[model samples]
Target: MKKLLTFSKQAVLIAVPISLVISIYVNSLVTILFLLVFLPDLIKNFKKNNFSKNRKVFFVFSAFVLVYLIGIAIDILYGTANFRKSERLLPFILFPLFLLFSDALTVFEDKKTPLKIFGIFVLCFNLFLLVNLFTQTVVEYNDNSLSNKRWKKSNIKILENSKERYALFPVSEIHIADVASRPDLLMERSFKFSRDTLITRSVYVKSNDDVWLLLRQFDGNRHEGAWFHPKTARVGFVQKNITADIQKLENGWSRISVTNRVAKKANRERLQITFVDENKQYDVKGNVEYQLYVGGTQLEIGDSPSDYMPLQHRNFLEGFDRTTILNVVEGHPTYYSLFILISVLIIILFFRSGYVQFLGLVLNLVMLVLLGSKAAILTFFILLFLVLCFNFKNRDSRLKLLYVVIPLSIIAILSFSNTLNRFNQSLSSVTEKNDVVYLSTDKRIEMWKSVIDLPLLNLVLGNGNRHGYELLESSTALTLNSHNQYLEAVLCSGFIGLILLLFFVVGIFFVDFSARNNQLLILFVVLVGFNLFFENLLNRQWGIVFVAFFLSYIYKLGEVNE
Candidate 1:
């Protein structure tokens, strides 16, 4: 019986972490069976008649969970309870109930084992998402400038093959929204063409007034020199290249022949083609009777666009909104990414070899940037710097260059990817814009200010996050939670709840900082605690489960390694 009980505990220990991660991934309440992690101990807690000695453990260690319980009770009494908002406190209740009922949380305190299992699986899952991000965004044609470049092959080529052969700018970036936004929109693409290649495109032009479509040749890279050819030099690069009046273009998408007589020599030369659409403004909200269209460049060597290579309405070349990598793989990429990043960072700083640590650091940092959550990225850098400083404490003064070099290289690499650089861009813009990244720092600031400007009395117990949420929707660009978790805590439970949370966090750190595995615990707290300043992660399941599970697990092991 003793041996059987021991094996059951061991089995639950391993299975618990796996369950936590998979439960969140599958995102089904049914997967919450991971709660069995604390079941054995909870039974012990309930059977303790008076709960005598366990009471102190409950107050000292359970304050973190108590914070939420108090808030929920208050909200319930006030009749302002939001079920989703109220439920964020569930993890806190479970984790500490076990801790309170039992003398020690040792049964579940195999710290590295749970984290290692969770990290390995989460890492693989993230890598799959990363690979898919790269693959999914690259849709259209490939090398040799439209890969299978050839004559329209009107005589023999298969229909599917011919469309690819003659397509130019097949990845249509020319959106109706873009056209409505900018009337005189210019689109240009470079393609290598043999002198024998004839540049023929059929355009769909729609306008109430006469529209003059123009084409020009210039290097997209240098944005200067034209297609190199002996015959074209006679003009000294002057005319509008080629212009045509497509006033006869019917209702919307009618074919208009565009012939470029510029390229004379037959040798292969890279040439850029620019299509200039006639300027016309329309209602941006799609209320306009007529919308401008400038596409269908996917024509054969002949005059018309074929049915196979119709202009793509959506352009995959621009990438899926720059940072939907997690959106593609899962629903809660932002906070969830931070969770994974926190895991990888701990593994890098303390456990892995120097090279693997550095490699994982660089790669995951890039992934964080690509994931496009400003708070997560900021939390990453701050924690990384702290870890570096901690590790570098013993190094000689001569090694300080690493301190500067490491961070700068990361920033430099991340800077190159514009999609996720909202944090970087907000530094310069006087008026913040959400061009690529979803949220801007200024927008977050604006959201924070809404909470600050509230009456002092109302803020004391906050009208609840539902009220705060209404404030976000009314005051800002979008409806979002309090971007600051501290604020979120206060909003949900009032300052008392916030105070309880902070005190518990500080208390846990003091207790755990003495463990031989304290390096891991310290870094983990730093990651999650710091991120709370920027995001309301506790409201979400990924954050709720991960933080509660690991913190309790570590709490059980705290100082025991000593």
Candidate 2:
């Protein structure tokens, strides 16, 4: 029975990554279930020698779990039960199981073989991931330009493989209301227009295009509704029967000029210019139409458009309303990053090579710099500078270089930034001109504030595995997860859960520095801590898996003996 159990463990150890890879294509739910089923055994492994061998580490771990659980209780009390609530429940039982199994394994068997095998698995997996990412990037870039004006094969492939059918840029952007109160035509109400109705009259105007006539027309009803979709819009002409005598010049950027010869005695039918586009079909309103024609062309055309803009023809169009972030695996790429960090630590622990140790440190720092956490990105330069001032070696030369480079970098970025801002605002102006209201501001602030209010008690006992968004929503302005990690910890567990988390963080740093298992652990820890500031740190599969995998690595590193 023991032999069979051992064999099962080894099999799982090998099969987990394979399963994860397949899950990228098959089903994320199944992969997640498989991990959940195996979690208890995984946690049990952490309970080595009854945790008596490392009392401090065990206490830290225990406190963390306890706080997390308490948070779960709070959430339950608060009526935040939802799908995430079930997820929050998972770590409670599964985490302890991981500790238990880990403890048992540590006490009974040699760690070297298993740890080495796991390291090999991580290395191979990382190689595959790197190769895939590199190839994909190459192919993607070759097929598409950096300007984003062209499509890539990968994108096309994704579209082809998708279960749904869709069109890119199928809609026209310009929408004008048909009705107006008076002849001035400057105050017409704007309404939503269908994409299908927009393209027939939309055109791209070059920088050299005559702007005098068009700019005045643009002022009348440029954007009247919520401008959410960001697409380009310019001037174009639509042919009408009354203007059939005029040549139909339909070159995309042609200067459309109209000449009308209606006699003064011709009964008072208004002369007007009309544009029919793929997104909408509508007639131009009022004197606003005359203002749109060039100087000489204005005289060549007929009488001015009437002031009575009708309110009858309004189209109520809405932008694409919902979006879902697709997951290739049960989690995201970052989830696997923690496992990679662990593998490096394991190699340093068993190999005992200074070269490997240095390599680990470099890789760890790079990863944290890239994906550690949002907090880390914001504060890394400051922290690095502080370290250089204190404990970091080769400080003098680097400090001088950094001092010069930092100021120069800031100045260069600022100088070039105006160009970037103009480019962005140009698009924003064209797209959002129609929007009367938007929801970007209040929602972000609300979620952030809610995260800050998590209580200490909730930090120990985890709230649960899943209910992060539900628990934090009340305190937030938007329907979002607690972007702060400490709050996420309290929301998921309780004070006890937080303690376990603190233990997890502290353990990684201590092991990183004391055991010298892999110096990279410090960077990884920093990254995770930083990420906690802006994102719900552990509600998603990627977050959970990454945290677990990294902690396991830290433990392995700490256990390495001199």
Candidate 3:
């Protein structure tokens, strides 16, 4: 019975960390499995009556879960209870409860064992994501090449593929709400054409009298085109081997004149008018009413409408979003990378092999570059500096300095090059009036402004659990929660809740810092502090799991190695 019980405990211990890593990649399955696997251990711990002897331990462990519970109670009292929102807090409750009651801390006798396993898994996951990202890029590049050729041949132009640009400018600026309101004043009365005899035009006018004639022609089958608006007289031309046919037009006023010298060969070819806006380009078909003139035919343009289509929309190999790596893992790369980085640091500190530590450091630095998190990179350097400074006495000063300086130089060069490239891209976007680079920063500012403008009551008790969506909807029509975790806590549970959370974090850091002279603990605390400023760490499942596991591990170890 004793052996079986011990085996069960060992299985649960290994399963828990494995499940946590899996949760980073999969969705809710890991969380469900985590709870189920830990259940038996929870019962065993309860039976053993192993509550932390220290009162501070109890408070620190319970603070986050208790705050959530208080928010739930407030919701019930205020008649704004939401089960979905409350469910998110389950990790906070369950993780801490499991850590406090169960033998989670005692699972691995070696302090670094769990972290080493976790590091290996995380490293593998990152490599998988990297491979997937590269594969997608290659596939998309081929697709884009084919699509681009087809589009170019048909005189259609595709703009830079960006979510913000696509959303803001569709087929034409005339389709914009402001432009549509007063079409006569805002319309670009111009017709454009490329070198290959392909012509494209758009016309919008409040009254038929306001319409103006514009003409241009495609030159040598090239993608570049030109626009011409004739002020005084209408310019007409007849092509030898071309026929013009307009498809459909609605809720607009326009006219077109197409002259075909080869009248006997009336090949019905549809007129494709490619509309070019500030950021996007697409083609539309229109019906051209033709009347025979002395030498040619006059065409009257009718209602023409088209669904704005991208000519070539595909991921590129050379210019891929760094966040593509995050998509494969289905989580923020920075957050996960930080976890791996901390794991690497733990291995270096405990393993005591210079070469192994060097390799781990290199891997972490590479991961940080791929992750492209400015905060994580900064935190890494700080941690590196601290680790070197602390260990200076143990190692030769020259060797320590060499190790620190060389890695720092390499990281600096790589990071600087990456930053420069991003900056140049951002500059080009700014010039084009595409503000994708600053979208997140602007939204965060907007959210902060909205949160600050909240009512006194809501501010005090927090608007209740999951009230962030409601607040955002009322203020900005956005359904996102407070991106800042500190703000999230305050918005959910008020000042009192925020206080409890701060106490929990501060208490843990204090205990860890005071209990030992361990550099790893100090580094962990620094990372946590930096993360808290940006992310509502406790609100996320992985975040909660990370905090709970590490806190429990550190708390349990408590000056053992130091």
Pick by TM-score: which candidate is best?
Answer: 3
Residue 254 accuracy (lDDT) in model 2: 26
Model 1's lDDT to the true fold? 0.50
TM-score of each: 0.61, 0.45, 0.62
Cα lDDT tens digits, model 2, 34-98, are: 45545665555444446554455444434444555555566577675444434543543343335
The sequence of per-residue lDDT tens digits that candidate 3 reaches over residues 2-38 is 6665665566555565665555544356556556756
Ranking by TM-score: 3, 1, 2
lDDT of 1 by residue, 105-194 (tens): 354455455556655666666677777766644533222222232111111112233222112432222223222332223223323343
TM-score of 2: 0.45
Question: Native-vs-model 3 lDDT?
Answer: 0.50
Candidate 2: residue 48 Cα off by (Å): 12
Residue 384 Cα positional deviation in candidate 1, in Å, after optimal superposition? 2.6
Count of residue pairs whose backbone atoms collide, per candidate: 1, 109, 21
